[model samples]
Target chain A: MRVFRKQDEMTVKKLVTYLVLGFVGLFMLLPFLWMLSTSVKPASDVFTSFENPIKAFVPRETQWRNFPRVYDTTRAMGGGFARWYLNSVLVAVVVTLGQVTTSACAAYAFARLRFPGRDKLFLGYLATMMIPGAVTMIPNFILMRKITEWLTVVAPMVDWDASRVVSVFGRTYDAGRLVGLDSYFALAVPAMFSAYGTFMLRQYFLSIPRDLEEAATIDGCGLFRIFTTIILPLSKPALATLTIFTFMGNWQSFYWPLIVLTQDSMKTLPLGLLSFMGLYSTQWSLLMAGSMMMILPMIIVFLVGQKWFISGIQLGALKG
Target chain B: MAQTTRGRTALAGYLFLLPNLLGFLAFTLLPVLASLALSFYAWDLFTSPRFVGLHNFIALMRDRDFWYYAYNTVFLMLAIPVNILGSLLLAVVMNQKLRGIVVFRAMYFLPSIVAGVGTYLLWRWIYNPDYGLINTIIASWFPQWLSDGIRGLGVEWPPQWLTSVTWAKPALMFMSFWTVVGGYNMILYLAALQGVSPELYEAADIDGANAWQRFWAITWPMVSPTTFFVLTMSLIGGLQGGFEQAFVMTRGGPAGATTTISYYIYNHAFTWNHMGYAAAIAWVLFAVVFGVTLVNWRFGGRIVHY
Candidate 1:
């Protein structure tokens, strides 16, 4: 009887846990479900379907064309969703690749190679992580503007047309507008060197056994060779974690991009989506469709790299 | 030979660090210092910067709008404690070794992963007064008398959530809670819980301690370190946050109901071109963050167990 009672209590406890979990899970999922439902509904149905909760989530007929309609409307408004999508991809990829490479190289130095003031320098990097982005925003903007001014002044002296045009990937670009304000350089360059990434990668690199590097050294291996052959290969998980994080961060980045990119063509997805919202505030269906497009890649990336994402967050908190 | 090799290693180290160092100097270090210097001077982009000593900081003190926005920032941060507790509870539930728990964890974490302007926009739509999800549900599901009772409490029948001045801050807080309840805090707590020794739980069982007792006595103290860490991070982040939400969702609101300090800085710096004032506000924000972090460390360190 005692044993049976204990088993019953255990079962009851498990059931209670499941009940709580399920309730919270439903609360979490409802917003996402509503987003999907709204994305497929006609504009009129958005306000009407709310009278019935079930009907609100299940449209009478899925407006499959709402997706394409968003593309059309945004394109008509001077910024195409496809262009913003490509820009987001390009910026995220560049920032991620650049950050990882720079961070890894720096992490290798900090973790392995002994140098004077290395610890102090690493500490400085760590301390800057606490400084808010607001402090850097104004000066950086000014810096970019100055660079643009300098380029404008020097372009003519070098016999180059600052407004020279080129086209690639079916998109037109000002070939001479290589760097500075409102350019891809503004979007990708400043973000490429992250103290957080360096700190995280350095922590990971410190954990790597030094014996392999030592052995390579004994065999007359150069520092760069050992880093390339051994450290880079071994730190794949760390590299991957940083890559996914930086990509997602840059992809979802809104503030700096908003401040920097004034041209519709230069706008990223978040900015594009915001402008789309501004234009079609009343059109819930189209707005939802635009948002769905913006959110889908992040969801896919999260699902694919969730293991690293979760572990990376945990690793970051370890020091904190 | 040894000295030569050491010098070569140092050279290699500097070489490896060159790219990041240059970027950091130009971007972060220089900008930080320049922002401080700019705070002491007045410049409106086209105009030359004129040093005005402590004028900007003095003006900031007298600026009623700054205080109001600072209050708004703090008001929004009221969600942090609730979020911490909610995530802790969620993490406790997630730390269980039950079947299909990972799916539930993933579901809970979904909102946080999708957090951005898109999520904010979705919430804005959901907070729509006439046709929003919450009001519609309340209108449909609630008994007429209950709705009337709520109406009697001075809130509108379907509550003008994002529209009403009184409800806007609360509405944003609610959205913040929903977004962060199962995010990094929960994951951190889950990691912390997993690190706890099962032997302690066995000992508690031997003492015939109930679930609540076990949690309060053993679990709480064990996870205090993580709690301290989470609290500090959340506080710092909360202080700096609200810019995106204010910009994307409310545009600093119906009547400046959601204008945080960060948004205030943005307006001054970018919109109004009060560069010195904006820089001063940014520096003040940094000071507050620094002071708060120090206090958190001082107090939280005492409570946190190894």
Candidate 2:
């Protein structure tokens, strides 16, 4: 009788737990559902659906054109979304490539090779992570401005003012201004060498067996060749983890991009969306559509690389 | 182990490090030192810096807006416990050895990686008094009296959340909680929970300990290290939190209700062009973060079981 009573209590507890979890899960999922709902609702239906909350979740007629309208630069609602998308893609891709390359090279040194003051230098590098980013923002801004001024002085004295330099996307500077204000270089370059990436990669590299590298060295392979042939191939998971993180970070970066790229054409998606909010604060459907566009790539990436994302986070936790 | 070989290896190491070292020197280390120095000197971007020892810090103490923003920042950190505990509870639920748990975990973790600006904007829509999700849901679900009673207690009916001064900070805190309740914190806790040995629970069961006793004596102690880690990280992040949300949703307004130290610093540096003053604010923020971290390490470290 007592065992049956205990069994009944266990059933009750389990049911309550599941019920609570389901409710909280629904609450957590509501915003995404609402965002999707808002995206497809016609502009008039958006405000009207608010009268009935249930109707708000279900669009009267799905406006699929809202997605394309986001990219239509000619429309009042679509202000350079294509340009911003291109800029964001370019910056994220290039920055990820640069950061992974630099971090791997540096990690190889710190993890594998002997160096004077190596441990001390690494400690210093790690310590920099503790210094909050707010401390660096002002000084970096000043430095960027100084660089622009110095470039103006050193580069050919063009008759054109700095403001007239159309874009800073090209390798050749025949149009002048390689990295000043409104430049992709300014957007991507400062973010290319990550201390966290180097640290994580070093930890990963240290876990690799020394026997493989020693054998490669005996085979007349130089350090660069060994790194490229052996370590790079071996550390695919680590590289993928770092690449996904760096790309997502750069893609969604707001403040630095906002500071550097004042021109409309140079704005990344997040910055573009910020301006979109300012201009169309009341247009809920349009704003939702724009945001959906902004976040779609991130969601896709997360879905595709969900395993790496979870493991990467778990790895960082282990380091801590 | 050979000296000559060590010397050659060191050269090779330096060659590998040169690119990152140069970038780090130019970007991070030098700028960090420069920021400290710049806090002492007054400079607009167009003008030369003027040496003004401790003037910025002194001015900050006198600035009413700075104090208000600082208060707002500290107030928003009230959500830290909410976020930490909510994530812990969810992690407990998630740690159950059940079928299809990964899908639920993934759903919970989704909001965290969804773009920050997008999340903020979504919340902005949700907090809208007239047509927002929160208001609409409340109005539809709750009877008239409850809503009226809530308003009688002096909240705006359907709460002008981000727009109201009293409600804005709480609204922002709510958003922070929503973001983290199933995020990396939960994942960390889940990871920590998985590491707890089954033997501890089995031993407790053999000893006739109840579920609550088992949790407190075994599960709690086992997860304390993760708790400590989450606490430290959350506190540091909480201090720096309001800038992005406020920048997107509030712009530090409805009368600077959501203004935070980070936001204030950004404004002073960029919008106002008070670089020295901004650096001073940044330093103060750093000092607070550093002090809090130190305290957590000193006190909280004792309780954490590795």
Candidate 3:
């Protein structure tokens, strides 16, 4: 009787655990499910009565054209969804590449080389991380504006038309609009040098054994060559984590882009989606469709790098 | 020969660090210092800066909206404790050995992954007072008599979430809880849980301790380090957050009900071009964060077990 009671209690506990997990999982997924359902629903089906919640989620008929409609409508509204998507991709890719390269080189130096004031300089970088972005934002905005003014003055001297148009990937670009407030340079350049990335990579680099580097040094390999062939190849997981993080961050960046990129063409996905929301505030179906597109890439990136992402967070937290 | 090689190594180190250091100095370090100096000078972008010692700081002190927004910022951070607790609970549950647990964890983490303006927009639709999902669910699930009873208490049947002043901050807090409860905090706790020794739990079982007792005595203290870390990090983040949410959802609201300190800073600097005042406000915010962090470390270090 005692054994039977124990088994029954264990079964009850397991059942309760599964029930809690299932219920919470459903609660977590409900909003995404609603978003997917609403994106396919017709406009009339959106504001359903409170009689049947299940019926509210299930559309009368799928409106697959809502996606294309969102695309075309946003394009016509001067904030092209495609253009924003492309810009987000381009900026995220460039920023990730730039950040990884710079951080790795800096990390390699701090980890492997002996230099005066190296630790002090690294501590300075770490200290800056504690300063809130709010303090720096105003100054950065002013700097961008000053740079734009300087670029405008220099463009005429260099015989470059500020309004000249060029085409790449079938998209028109203002060719001379480089390294200024509304340009890609402003969007991608400043974001490339991250103190957080340098710190994380430096921690990882410190863990790598010195034997490999020593062996390569005896083989007459240069420092850059050792970094490229040994340190980087060994630190793939750390590099991947930083790449995914920076890409996701830049992709969904809103505030800086909103401040800098007033031109509709230069806006990223988050700003573009905000403007779309403003224009179609009442159109729930179209707004949901745009939102779905906006988050799809992020979801994909997250799923792909899910392993490295979780481990990286744990690594940083534990080490720090 | 050794000296020459040491010099060469230093040169290589500096060369390697040049790209990042130059950018960091120009972008981060310089701006930080400039922001501090700019706090003492009044400049409206188009005009030359004029020195005004302590004027901006004094003006900020007298500004009623600034105080109210600071209140809003603190009020919004009230969600952090609840979020941390929920994350801890969820992490404890997820640390169990079960079938397809990874899938469940991923589902819980999906909201945080999709967080940004997109998620904010989705919540805006969900929080719509008229035809929103929450209200619709509540209306359908609750019997008419129950809602009638609620209305009899002289309360609104469905809360006007974003539109109403009293409900807006709570609404944003609710959204934040949902987004963050199963996010990185949970993962960190899960990692912490995995690091706990099974021998302790076995000893507790041998002592005839109940499940709840085991948790409080063994699991809780064991994970206090992670708890401290999560609390400190969340406090810092929560104090600075609510900018994107306010900007996207409520435009700082019907009556500035949702405006956070960061949003206030943005309006002052960007919209009004009061660069000096904004910098002053930002410095105050930094002071608060720094003070809070120092307090956390001083007090939290005592409570954490190793």
Candidate 4:
């Protein structure tokens, strides 16, 4: 009788724990569920369910047209949905490529090479990470403006027309400018070099065995060749982590792009989405549809690379 | 010849570092120094900069918005402890051998991975006064007398969340906590919990310790280091936060109720063209962050168990 009582008590405790945890878990998912519900909700019927509390989570009739309508009309203004999507992809890809390539080279120098002031230089670089991005934001904005001004001043000397379109390497640009506000050059260049990327990669590089480099050197491989063949291939996991981080970060970046991209057409998706919010504040369905579109890529990436995403964060935390 | 080759190898290393070093100098290092100098000089982009030593700092002291924004910032930070503790509790619960727990963990972490702006937009709609997710529930399910009683006590029912000064900051904090409670912080805690030796728990169980006792004695101390890390990072992040969310949702407002120091700095520099004053605010923010980090290192290091 005593044993049975003990088992019953344990069962009750477990049951209660599960019930509490399940309730909390639902709350975690509540916002997303609400977002999806609102997206499919008809414009007229969106609020009708509010008369019933439990009914709020379910839509009376699903308006799947809401998603397509986002792209069909002027409500998708501020350079349209397509332009913003293209800009986001372009900036994220170029920024990721630049960040990874530069960080890898820097990490290689720090990890394997001996040179004067290397340690001191790296320490100085590490110290840059301590300075928050907000502090540097103003100066960088000023820097961008200064560069644009200089380009404008020198445009006449090169017979360049600032307002005219010019094409190079299948990419179009203003014939008059190299770096200016609302330009892709302004967006991609400043984001390329990352101290955190260099630090993370350098740690990974240090863990790689020295024997591979030594054997390559004996086989008459130059530094460049060794780095291309030996170092990079061996460090694919670290590279992937940095790539995803940089790409995701650039995709989601708001402040810098918001400040820099003054023209509607030049705006990235996140910045473009803000204009949609401001214009369509009353239309919750359209807003939800736009938001779902904005978040779709990230969700897909997270789902596919969930393993790397989780492990990479854990590695970063361990390093910190 | 060998010495010459050794020198050449060093040159190659330096060559490899040149591109990143140049970017660092131009973008990161130069801007840091320039911003520091700009803090003491007044310029509005069209005009030449003029030095005005300590004037900007003094002006900041008198600006009421600065103080209000500072308060808003600190008020937002009140959620940090709540976030850490909440995540810790969730992590402990998640460490159990429950079925479908992996799915539960994924569901919980989903919000954190989604883009920030989307999350904010979701909450903005949720906090809608008339038909929002929150107010809808309150309107239908909540007893009328309870709302009337609260109103009789001088508070409004189904509060105007983002638009009302009284509830804006708290609403933002709630959204932040909800997003972060199951985020990377929870994962860190979970990892730390898994690292704790099972032998200690077994020994405690042998001593007739209950679940609560086992957690308080063995689990808590074992996870203190992770707690320290989370606390420090969260504090740093908290102080610098509110810029993105405020800029998007509130634009720092219902009469500047949600203007954090970061948003204020952006407003001064970009919107008002008060570049010097903005730089001064930026420096002030940096100093506060640095000071808090120092305090955490000094105090947190001692209490954090290995």
Candidate 5:
């Protein structure tokens, strides 16, 4: 009986520890809860705090129409959300794929290939990571404007006003001639040449054990074969980590996309939502709704890949 | 054979890195170098830059707002260390291997995930005095912080936190702290806790060391590496402060109480279009970051048992 009682006490202690952590965790999570609740709350009940933070969770009624309102309000903005979502998805996917490929290729080269200048070049890559992106924003935007000018080997057929055409970017209204996804190239191409991803991946790839590659070489495996069969499989964790990071970053990107994408039809989510808020300041509920929708995909992605997400973060922060 | 293969490998390596190299040069590296050069010239998005050297730097040194920006940013750096203590205490309690840990970890990590625009909007709503969760709660308890009122229980009314000049900085600090809580630091400390050797615990038990002794001796020493990382990252991020939060929340509000150096720099570059002056502001940030990072790298390395 005494032993059982002691065991019960220990269990209670354990439970208390968990409860304390759980409460703190919930406290950390309050900002998000506040967001979720605020998102669904009726406009009348938004500011009123009774027992809890939000009225939706409280006894007050839920307004499901808020979501639809957000969707409708955003659509009124020249590109609407459908366009912004498409643009964000297109940009993020293309940038992630491009960055991953670019990074993997470079990292592989640096890690496995015995080049004379490789170390120096890798060092050069690492050096650039120290420079803040904000510092580079103005110059990069200017550079993109120049690229739009330079990439007229096949001139875009649009006779338009100089303000819209010559400045920021030019466009062709005729969709029939526009092929191979033009905006995709514009946003993704610059990101494909990202150095930070390469620097990180190179460090990761270098940490990989060399014994397996050595055996593959002895077995007469070609470089491509070894990379395809062995290196690709082994480096999945690093690759996944990079993929997730690049996806999230490109997804949430505001400043760069804001600068380059001039056509209202071509706006990405962050820029689009910001512009929408500016235009529709009166529609507080709608603004919150769009904000929720913008970040929903990220939350879904994180929840789905929580294990990998946690592992990747812990690994990157600690290892780097 | 090895030497020839090594040379071939070098050629192949360069070829593989070509795409990234091109992108880096075009997108990031060139722009950064250009910014350093741009600091010496005046350009307003369009037209050629006229070389007017040292004027921008000179203006930054003399600018009153520049000093104010520095003060606001440093206010955060000063406040954040105190802010992190609450979380550290919580982590110490939470780090125990108890049930529902996964749930707790998820809960703590949710805010960081909800960051950028979403989190910003939430805080903005909460900071709204008339219809905010914070004021309603505070009003119920004391009713003084929101407006003029003395509690019958013998308490003086605090000023409007987010609006009052004296309390504006504190309000901003509190909101920022509340947004993150102990999140990333707790995750780090949790990892550090999990990595502690059981042998150390067993040895301490044999030596008659109590929980406090074991913690100070075994846990603290073992977690030094994680501590170093957290501290360094915190210091780095703390100095820059959060741009969007300040921008959207206060717009440097309540008589520039929340105006950070980064925000000021942003205003110059984006809003005011003082490109040279903005770049000069950026250089000041860079210098400060460089100095602090150097100091941290040295001090963090020295204190870190690893």
Candidate 6:
């Protein structure tokens, strides 16, 4: 009787676990699988009935031309798709680098250094994260307009208040005003420092045991040396985790770049996608093609670096 | 390590923190305070802000679209528990002694890493009324189950998805599920699962506690802290309901069926450039989120085991 009960109980557990997991995995993966299928599928396969999952698996004709078209200028119009992609990459890279560096230095000080009102200051920093970005939109924009205007100081000299000069991209435009070269700095500079990263990293640092720091101090290590040699080495896992998330997020950023960048060459990926909608109309084929190109890089990164994402979140639990 | 001296190290810490401190104040703190003042005024993008007292707040109380977005946002919140449960289940399934679990997990998480716009575009195609993969398969064998007259035009022909009020909330909620269920929550649960003690399971096996009882008594409680965090984060994020999807998917369309509070605020601020009124909307959201979070914490304090 006991043996019978044991067998019955184990089977129920197994069944429950599988059903629960099956339902969830199916939901999470449906969208991505659908995308990959859409990218590679032909037109007939593009729209079947979504009510059923089976049609998604079948392909009618594989329209591969769409992928390359997403890269071409005729499709993109404002400029070459490659330039927009390149600009986005450059801006995201610069912004991510600046954010990590600035945040790390600040976090280190909050964690290891001594300063006045340290507790109060840290509290103040945490408080900042609660504020929504909408509050500062107009102010920041006005600030940027003023700054960008000042940057164009040379535009007047170039214009000579007389004539315009032609440049290599083959267009003769006013060299007149000091308008900046539609620079990436306008996007990257403002986003470089963040209160969020500081809060996350500072929390991670506090969880580290103090014994390691003491040992470094015993070795007559200077503050910077201790930071570089001890703290940084120990924080590798956390930093890597932050890098992936911040990189992915910034790479996908849209609104800020849209608001700040008026020049054609300055648009980021999300804005690039948004702009595509205006020219493409309702063409699903081309839109999917553009969407695929934009998403593929992030997919590749996440696939190769899945461990860090888990490690990053788990860090909270492990330390707690 | 010894908590150091009350001297130069502390001084250096302050110095190191200055950049971030200044940044937070300049960018975040000052704006929050300024927004409070904005909530009391009327201002446009071109003109200077004018103080008008609590008029914006009173206006918010009566605004129909504002209430509609709140109602829709509440509907989105209902999906949270479902999402959390679904993700936890996925984690448990993938966490098994199965082969190629890592790849499966990666595949599962793929949607989340992609840009939200990209995800929306892909889903839009899938949700198309005519040629969408979803309707196609369902239509072939089970005609009754499929929604009729799909244009095969994909989103050009999508079933008024995310745009029609009746279906907009559900569509947005479905997309939210598609976007995050497996990919977003799965990673966190998998982490929590790995931490569950094998010894406890072994002990439960020996103690005549059945698998069901073991899960209830041992596993469930162990994962409560993660559950609380996930719950809180989801509720908070759900309230905001990321603007990109609504902005792109519905544009608060079909008579504004899908606008969440965040999208409404975005419209007022960036679209209409109603800086003062937009600030007011933002404050209201902050209050709602803040208020809900406090309530969660108060209740959470009792049951969150970690």
Per-model TM-score, in order, reads: 0.97, 0.94, 0.97, 0.95, 0.88, 0.85
Q: Where in model 5 is the C-alpha error above 4 Å? A: A1-9, A47-59, A146-186, A261-263, B1-4, B83-87, B142-164, B202-213
True contacts kept of each: 0.75, 0.68, 0.78, 0.63, 0.61, 0.67
lDDT of 4: 0.86
Between candidates 4 and 5, the DockQ winner: 4
Which of the two, 1 or 6, has more DockQ?
1
| Candidate 1 chain B weakest ten by summed lDDT | B150-159
Worst 10 residues of 2 chain A by lDDT: A169-178
Candidate DockQ scores, in order: 0.79, 0.73, 0.82, 0.71, 0.57, 0.47
Which 10-residue span in candidate 2 chain B carries the lowest summed lDDT?
A: B94-103
CA lDDT of each prediction against the hidden true structure: 0.89, 0.85, 0.89, 0.86, 0.71, 0.71
**Docking category for candidate 2?**
medium
> What is the overall TM-score of model 5 with all chains considered together?
0.88
Clashes per candidate (backbone, < 3 Å): 0, 0, 0, 0, 2, 31
lDDT of 5 by residue, A202-261 (tens): 777778898999999899987777777888788888788888888988887765565566
Misplaced by over 4 Å in model 2 are A1-17, A49-51, A73-79, A158-177, B1-4
Per-residue CA lDDT of model 4 for B144-251, tens digit only, reads 989999989987567999999989999999998888998899999999999998999989989999989998999889999898888889888888889998887888
Instruction: List the candidates ranked by DockQ, beginning with the highest.
Output: 3, 1, 2, 4, 5, 6
Candidate 5 or 2, higher lDDT: 2
- Deviation from truth (RMSD, Å), model 4: 2.4
Query: Can you list the residue pairs that collide in candidate 5?
Result: A115-B10, A193-B23
Tens digits of per-residue lDDT for model 3, A117-183? 9999999998888788999988999988777576557665653224346788998765325665777
Q: Residue A257: error of model 2 in Å?
A: 0.7
- RMSD of every candidate to native, in Å, equals 1.7, 2.8, 1.7, 2.4, 4.4, 5.1
C-alpha RMSD between model 1 and the true structure: 1.7
Better of 3 and 6 by lDDT: 3
Candidate 6 lDDT over A267-302, as tens digits, reads: 676777777776764666677777878888887878
